[model samples]
Target: MYPQRDVRVRHARDLAFSLLTPEDAFELLAFEIAERAWFEQHIEARREQFYTPHGMSQHIIECLALNAQGRMSPLLIRHKGVIIGRANLHDIDQNSARVGYRLAENACGQGIAHKALNHLMKEARCIYGLDTLTATVSVDNKASQRVLEKAKFTVVDKLPTYSQVVDQRLGCVVYQCALREKVECP
Candidate 1:
């Protein structure tokens, strides 16, 4: 289950990350469509239907369902009362999860991503009890690689053809971070 409270803090700027709710569907949809080109530069394009109101609403339903099943956490990032991005914990298991995030083109280069990631890291460890977090970034996306590195994630593997980005295969680097020290009983 997601924490009942939203997280707000002052780092480079005042930013809040909250659990995705059904009410956020349209606004988040607008943000997604507006940044489609920029997003596609680093990640795969979504199906055409996903750009529609009903389709985006359905996507949120699926995300919330997984969250209810304790399988994932999908979050929305807001700045100044505007939806600016998203951060997600995918493939969550007992002690680990894969992290991913995206920012609006206007939200780039302001340390927002780094701070947002660090906040998500805390949520992963403290709220979800995950001890390890991993992220896969395209080798060509230096900005994202740097953000992960600055968040203390280390590169663990490199896949030559990991994912699709705008119809092309993209090579990716997998990075991992230990959220907490795992102790063993003697």
Candidate 2:
């Protein structure tokens, strides 16, 4: 059972990122289609900074397979059974967890990212046994920075000229969230 099974944050507010099941593959396929055009037009060029659509979709499938094998616990954010986005707890250490997410371009400006972050934070604390959450974001993505801030992540440091995906010495902002506080699971 999920550790946060008994704890549902009201702020989830119609947004949810429950565990992804094998049956959700078709759902994910649908989401891929829905977000394809936007991703191609807006996010594709920055393939080095972010995963390509094909790569992301394959990663999703792999995560699902891992989950089924009891190797990971990944969640997919959806509305009314239609997948919209995803936030995952990967690269987990004894005390920290690496988190990442992507939303369909049309899903931006909605509370989806915020809610997903909140949900992951809660799960990290209650289920994943984590103390801190870390996120590495490309320097140019103001929108991601905003989402991290809204989720109460603080800018911890800036690493200069890192990552091959970024062609020109783009700095990376490291953000973190502490789960020791009384966080409301969203």
lDDT of 1 by residue, 44-142 (tens): 889999988999999999999999988889999888777778999889999999999998877787788887788778878888889999999999999
Which lDDT values do the candidates have, in the order given?
Answer: 0.84, 0.69
lDDT, candidate 2, 22-119, per-residue tens = 56655565565556555544232333312344555666678877666544668888665456677788877678788887776656776777777877
In candidate 1, which residue pairs get closer than 3 Å at backbone N, Cα or C atoms, i.e. clash? none
Q: Per-prediction count of colliding residue pairs?
A: 0, 0
Cα lDDT over the full model 2: 0.69
Off by over 4 Å in 1: 1-11, 181-186
Q: How far is each candidate from the true structure, as Cα RMSD in Å? A: 6.3, 8.0
